[model samples]
Target: MQTVCRDAPGCPEPGPGYPDLGAVPLVALNVSVRRRLGLYLNPRAAVAADWAALAEALGYEYLEIRALEAQPDPSARLLDDWQGRGGATVGRLLELLRDLGRHDILAELRGRIEEDCKKYLQRQEQPVQVPAVDSSVVRTLEMSGITTRDDPYGNVPELFDAFICYCQKDLHFVQDMIKELEQTTFKLKLCVFDRDVLPGSCVWSITSELIERRCRKMVVVISDDYLQSNECDFQTKFALSLSPGARQKRLIPVKCKAMKNEFPSILRFITICDYTNPCTQKWFWIRLAKALLVP
Candidate 1:
């Protein structure tokens, strides 16, 4: 897994008088905290005057103000500033935390920030899993290093034909689907999270770019776990935003374990590929392959 510090570049390092958070696990600084901070900061609502007031009131240094201003999005810039703190950053952050009456959250954030700094200093290499592609055609394409430049359709060049959006709980089933798809006559290039995301790259950036702009299709593994996951929700919404209405067909929802009612209001109406049915499993993949335009 990519270290949290890399994802939040310039994260503050622990200085004198702060609680030592060296022992905190890297996983403890997960997406939830980032999401929470994003919601809390509401960067879009912060005006120029508010920033100037904050800087003057907090005595923020040039580096801090510059860092905060660099991010185009409010939430992202907030995260960057939060992570990018050092001695000065920590002091300012602490004051803000105290004013907000979020000491408990600050304590948790302190641990995560310290842990991230340590990981960045260590230059750790995140372990990456090689993607498992079942289709012989895709395997051959991978070996041959074929790319979207070779596409006969003259569409926007894509690194992969499809990006698979699924929860960790559905990995086994997804792997099985990949294997079955491999046997199909058509070549399917898929971007599975565990396998495709390069080590050290920001997970959110890579996922967003691929799912929303780069990939030709998005295959969502629909399940209870998927619906509940914040990251999955983001991926689904981002994909849906790009392809709405009948164009929503670009988003292929595979029913792995979710009930009809469990699906979000927007997704309930779409024709889902029900992989949950044993009798129709074969037919489902075949139909899915056809929908994906498998040769």
Candidate 2:
């Protein structure tokens, strides 16, 4: 029946003689009611501006308008300019708030904004779908060993000692691993998807052949993202096919995250090097180098 300021320090109640607003939600309040009742709100223009800035910093611009709406004297021009920007985030928040019918506490709103942003980013970060290698193509590569024949470095029978199979999202971790391996005394040649594949070459052609024939061992960087990727799935299957009897020797699993429960059924039996643990990093490199049989 009465308007309450949820954002301010004291949760200030509306003054005497002010209209009751009759449980109408702030979002649905008409411009006339807002113009009359807005003065009683605790967060003045300055505080509202600070809230807007905080929301923008958290990557939720939608909260900016809602923040301004809490102010006693919000700038109409500023609200118009914010709406003009027209981001998906703003639209999403507006819809969510409208459906809820009331504003939440500022802290609760901040948490919600962060969670929504993270989910949105995760959706956008989905791995690029790499076309699956045809069964006929797999058989052809296996029978002819065309990967070796097509190799630019013909004389060197072993094109790469180890192939680093990973999701593109984990590239930063993979790059760091490559850098560390390079710095080591071991004479190990690593094959990475981005660096090893020749420019203008079809991605599937390079990846499939390299996993099937060229690389002696495949170091699969396991994570939730990796499990969901078609490319990683294809590469892992090919690597597993190469080592029928002894998979551990040919296919090494490196745990970039705790993925034992989510790992593929075929690979579950094998021991995984837990690189996710900071204390085990040195040991992880040693174990992986040994697995690759680095000289």
Candidate 3:
């Protein structure tokens, strides 16, 4: 265990005012208002391998998902439009990093190592060898004799490979569909109505945040009820606004039942996946898996 300077998030040597954050539980740290001042919750753990510690040091709020949580239906979260939606699997995030140059990444690793060491001290853990800023060599570091050299964000591992948003009324069918897809090992991060919302989080605010910042792509489970609900309108509108490319590319409309097209003007160009066909569920999952895996 040793005291070290991470200095990320523009904080001083120990990382802002709460120097002991390295010792705090990540879950608790996430809810602490003081720690969220400068940090953005990194859903992709590229910047810090041990995002738990990074959150403590930088005051990042929100759960940083390295891999999606375990689930029964994997396809529930798999994005169907990866190429058009600007999403790459964990494998792609790795390729992107490697393409940026290994030495440069190693330099970043060195800084992250230092930060991890400080955080480890709070856990009564051993310190590992971390490189200095000028050091060019990438040494394998071990705590308790275990090496830590893997990229945290670059790998496709989890159930429900993507996050899906829909009205609660459709959960019965959605869950069944997701279950079928999970047989193919697609994991999803679909939002469960009441279980997912924490007490402190504003429901509307959280919904907007998830649609805008969390989901790689947004799917609207289209039905007559969905189109008529105010809540549904809010979510679909938010999804349309956060889309990265042309509206047609990102907003996916899944027609589960008979429904009228009530999309806003911005979402007019979006593509619709009418699951009305007998094979729509299977075909959509296959397409989605390919999209998430290939690019």
* TM-score against native, each model: 0.46, 0.46, 0.40
Worst ten-residue run, lDDT, model 3? 26-35
Per TM-score, what order, best first? 1, 2, 3
Predicted structure 1: lDDT: 0.56
lDDT of all predictions, in order shown? 0.56, 0.54, 0.41
Name model 2 segments beyond 4 Å from true. Answer: 1-158, 245-248, 259-261
Report the lDDT tens digits of candidate 3 across residue range 37-71.
11222233565333233323333234422231231
RMSD of each: 14.0, 19.8, 19.4
1-295: candidate 1 lDDT, tens digit per residue: 1222222323454455433333322222334454555454534344222333345455667777676666444443443333323232333444554454444445556565554435423322232335675454443333222233434332334466678888898899889877877645656767777865545545555566677656778888887777578677667755664655435468888888746434543454467889878888778878887776632
Candidate 1 regions with alpha-carbon error over 4 angstroms: 1-158, 258-261
Candidate 1 displacement at residue 77 in angstroms: 33
